[model samples]
Target: MHKRGQSFLGEVRDQIRSKEAKDFVSAELNHHLKAAKNKWIEKGMDETEAEEKAVVQMGSPITLGQKLNKLHRPKVDWLTVMLLVTTLGLGFLPILFMDADYYLQYNMDASSFSVQKVVFSLLGAVLAFCVMLVNYRRLESFGWLFYSIGVLILVLLQNSFDMINGVSILVIGPFTINSLSVMPFFLLAWASFFNHKKLKLWHLSLLFVCSFWLFVNTVNLPAIYIYTFMVFGLFLCSRFSRKIKWMITGGIMGSLLLLGFIVWPSLEMYQLVRLLAFVNPEQYAEGEGYMMLLLQDHISKAGWFGNALNSGTIPNVHTDFVFVGFTYYFGWLAACALFIVLALFIVRIIMIARNIHEPFGKLLLNGAVALYTVQLVSNVGMTFGLVPITTISLPFISYGLIPIVLNAFIVGVVLSVYRRKDLTSMRTFQPQQ
Candidate 1:
């Protein structure tokens, strides 16, 4: 290459702060210079003269670099930020104003719970900001590593688990992390796998099989549902051929059917009853259907302005049953407003994903969308008795430290992706001699 073009690219690179952006800008400029030089040479100009002409045609390197720097600078989606703040505020309100008596059974008081909520909320915010500062593309290379780590965590939890209220938890010092907290890591890992250039159908099948095995060992139905949806969503968004996609889809469906057939009869009576309770809560109202019936009653009695019912009949009122408890206190009008906020937040994320040109970033965003959608639908559906009751908590609204922190990490990843959405260019340019 000519010294003039090399010097021009160097000057442009000096203006771009992001290393990734600089590489993209240099490649693009090099491609343009080569193309222009070729055109000049085609007109019978000497090769040296052609290179000089190409460099001159590029104009001032400083000015072009400045323009490119401005164009490729990292950006923040303020609307998403505002929506997150609003949701967190709404989540805090219920815990803040709940009757002090509710915490008594847990050997705590309302003030302490509020304090914990504030502390955890701040921690989550900091964690998210830290994640946002990172370049998400770098994570694409660690797909299998993350997957292995996630699997290891689950394995450890399985072998040394502590049962708290029928839920599996891992006790680390004073902290108790739920087994399902590993789902987000798996989500990222799967996204990386899907974005791999050498991805294959058998690789995905093995992943699914492994995930199913872990979920079965943990007996976490909600995690299984979320993982399945995420896998399917990522597969659809993958760059695989349509034929391979269909083949994998059919295989997954058939495997699920077969697994269900084999597992259904082996479920204990209580487990089977719990699975079928949502279909007819009235039938099992005294046992597995009791919570569903209670939730329905509370929701039905919640008028437009709410009944301000703080009777605390709903179990885990601040966690799994938060929405129901919130409705009983704040009424349907407030609930609808919360729903709208959540809907808009999700829609904003989808919009961000839509504008992303990078395939891996888009896959990560879509995977997040899939996970959030399932959780939102399932949690809300179970509250109204439309789906089976599980321990799934509403995202951002539930009062749990592990969940809030994990969700914040996801939000941070999304922010990181949006930050670089405009800086990456997928076009390949051959080197110019």
Candidate 2:
């Protein structure tokens, strides 16, 4: 090897041995270099030739380190986090002024955001653990069964159940599934993984058509529409029967047109107003455009660093407008950080989808990526007026405990995807059988 190559290799080796680097990152770095070297040697090159080719192919190791610097895997550093939480609690002085109502509604005393965060975090951890313990692939086996259960829960919620103690149990106690929260997984169960690939067009058509009809009673209409789009996206991913995709797409489109006709006369004036507002937001500024307009004002003033002290309050701050304080407090730096983190998560899912050994795994990950990406964009963009006002919350950052915990379940699923030892990892890229 050239002296330059030797020095670069030594630096990388030192990095691998240091505590600053993760095993996965270090391992992948080495794997890339080894791959480059193997390619040259496999071509019957001499040592110098192989070394030159390997070095060129692998890029400069220093540059590789710089590229990876920004992407260090997030660690759950509890000590730092706890200190941050303590500061946020004390800083509630400023925080309260911005979104005082949100804090007030939650009874923002000693245990407002902090205490609730603890509850939600623990809840998220438990749910994630349960999902982690189960065989994710096995989830495919009972796909339709799970789909039916999801529909049934949504039905019971809108039709029969009541939140007696402000809590409605999804499946009694042990497996309390929330209809609104579990929609992502339930939707994935049907559109992505049901054993309908070999089935005929009419079969797929019938199943989805009926699912939409039955689900509408409690499907959270916006979520249904979003999932419908995700279904089409996953259909494109599946190299399944072509007729199945066409039939299902045609059925959904046709059904939507028919439903629009049937429901138009009976639809509430408010719904029409909202739709009209979506068409022309500026025209309805005082009425339907209030949320969008106010949200923009708050975020704009948030500037680089968020509003000084407590002047940064935005309406619906905690739930819908949670980005308000974040912008003012952490400034654009924080806002940019959130967007980057979310993008990484979506990209990670897509990358994981590529690694799976089976079509079903690909299907699930694609559906999940769609769900995560769409909801994220809708939330942030709607807040900033890039889209119409949609009441979706940011997946991880929003204060809705149920969705927060649900998000943790998704994290676990992705981690489950990540840690699968049986899959074709970098060391052994056997073409899927």
Candidate 3:
């Protein structure tokens, strides 16, 4: 309560450049002053004298603030940055050398596609950088807003969206937005919701049920899978009681089972055929399994150092099957190397998430990791015929403007969390009585 303590804290705050770090620094400094003052008071010193001595014991405010400033300064994970850049470069190779004949069949220009990819990549990089500079903590309070926006986007896509290759897309002028694009909004929203200290079990259940219904209505299987996995990941990292956590886990499992039993019969002929093909690709080779068989054949022919094979016949070679095409041209060794880089990129982010002390930041990173991991595993698994084929794109490597940009935004968020990991205190600073 002394003027001396207040003046010292003000001086300390002046040295801290980051506005986000200022509150934490001030709180911690005040806590220390209060504790020291209480100690002097216990020793029978006068109140004013104790406060003055406590302030003096903290040493020069300018020096202490400068030290704290250095510790709390924004950091960049250059190693992760390098790994991401390496993966992006490797991903561009297949697109750069895509077969022109394949584009002709779809009435598209190969040259323009490559050029567009280049533009998108640049835009994605810029977006990542821009997002990295933002304070992620500011998003914690906007959970409901983000959730509403995400649900609205999904509803629009579900009701009146243009159909492209059986996938719903909203075409706005020159840009086409897919259902998957709503993921980041939902991811951040769920992260905020899970980290909420006062969120009730009933309210959480309602939110999950509503989101699940919207996702199901969209019929984007990849988005559904990613969303489900993300929610589970967030729940596991949430600060809920063990009983509540288990209840939620059981509820999700039961819902999925019930949906499977009810939705299976209602699935369209093509959807049923796709599922059947996944179970027995050889039996449905002439229909939905044709692509699966072709992928296997190409992968088998792709040697450690390439097989000199033309990958023109592969469908969506530049997008979904880009990995197979890359393997055919650059060899399995190169593909594995690329995979290692991707894995390292993911691991680096996980490591950063582990070090973060802030609940919301950690949740955000975990949610992103969950979504990316599922997309990576599912996409690669399908390419290897280990999982059912879906429209999931390889993160960062997929040839789409929206996917790349959205992925970059997620990466930027991870960077933002890493930037301030040191600045966050483990517990809230409180002044000693």
Candidate 4:
């Protein structure tokens, strides 16, 4: 056989070696080539000529191997899949407890709440699957569109409804839209547009104005903080220099301070009380501080291994303070285990983000990470009374639909990026003529 023919076949073998049945594949390939060579020789071709024709007839070795690679590759990230399933499963325990003690404790409709939660969870899972199937890069093209829509939603939400307990929930027909909960995702997705680019002063001004627009409409102070923090984190990860990052950081902090100053006097008495309670929960124990004080009392009772699934101990245990309730019911051991699993989950995401070579994908993952990590820290802080109580639900482990759905979608995006990380450049692999 000619050396070129041997090299061509060898390249094919190496490329397809990832296949499970590589040995059989290589053997069959070899047998077919040998038979072809023999036929060509009998047709009066020389050895080298027969070998060259056989290799050409087989087409480009690179293209063939890459095609086989795609077919044989396991694109699903099992680790993420397992983590998602396990986290969601554990999250249901709190809902179960809520259902069991509903009539006895809160006097709310437990069955209805449970049904709604289940339905949303299923819907979120479906959305996640759909997100995973879509190419993540295309999402960048729609970034501006999503941002515009999110902005429009925020405007409608702000103008359409009166404040309910200081925050507005926009009800458009049957769907309850917490524009605050869902709007940041659009911004995060749109961040791909600004990554690693030098923006003119006007561009920066536009962003600041847009962010300010969202900030003013947001009724929740803690959410404003989270949003600001996320934007700052994204800026830090941007292609800006250290000096620019510091400047942006300083600017953001100043803006937040100014915003707070502007809004502080306008805050509802209850909102003011809640903020003040963060300073002295003991002082407001019976009023705005009730939830914080209750969480502490429950944690004290928790000890190491919690006293079974007792209900009514922690108010609103199905949502905001689910972590505290979970710990109170299941004990510190369970809480610790949950924390460890969640930490591992974030770490896994960070690892994938680090490995991804694409700028936009990495930025998207970073945004997701920042969002999740901040929420995690804030929720845990609020649970233990280290931070001001906010409506931020614990990711995956909290009993809320919008947040759960959003979180699931973020995970799906990360998985999509991971699956296609290697395929980005090979989408249309072709050998030189």
68 Cα displacement, candidate 2 (Å): 30
lDDT of 2 at 200: 62
Q: For residues 1-108, could you state the per-residue lDDT of candidate 2 as single tens digits?
A: 466566656555443432333444556555655666677788999767776777666555665555444344333324323422332232233234444455666566
For candidate 1, the 10 contiguous residues with the lowest summed lDDT are: 424-433
Candidates sorted by TM-score, best first: 3, 1, 4, 2
Give one digit per residue, the lDDT tens place, for model 1 in 109-135.
777788898888888888878888888
* Candidates sorted by lDDT, best first: 3, 1, 4, 2
Residue 304 accuracy (lDDT) in model 4: 91
TM-score of each: 0.90, 0.66, 0.91, 0.78
Off by over 4 Å in 2: 1-102, 105-112, 160-178, 184-188, 191-196, 241-268, 421-433
Q: Estimate, for each residue in 1-433, the C-alpha lDDT of model 3 and write its tens digit.
A: 7898899899999999988789878877787888889999999999999999888888888988898899888898788677667766765787554666777876788678778888888888888888888888898999999999998888888875445666667778988877788888998899999888788867887998888888787767787888888888888888888998898789878987999999998999998888899888899989988989999988888889985555446788778887887777778998898777777767887898878878999999988888778878888899898988888888788788877887788788888888878886624433323
Worst 10 residues of 3 by lDDT: 424-433
lDDT assessment of candidate 2: 0.61
TM-score of 4: 0.78
lDDT by residue (tens digit), candidate 4, 1-433: 5687778767876776444335434555566667777878999999989888777777888777667666545387889888888887787888655655554576667677778777777877787778877777767777667666767666766765455557656776767776556545564544665562655646755865686577567565656666666665666777767997788668867987999999999999988987898888889988987777888888889979886746546767887888998888788999999988877778988999888878888888887787778878998888888887788888887876777887788788878777767644433333233
For all candidates in order, the CA lDDT equals: 0.81, 0.61, 0.82, 0.73
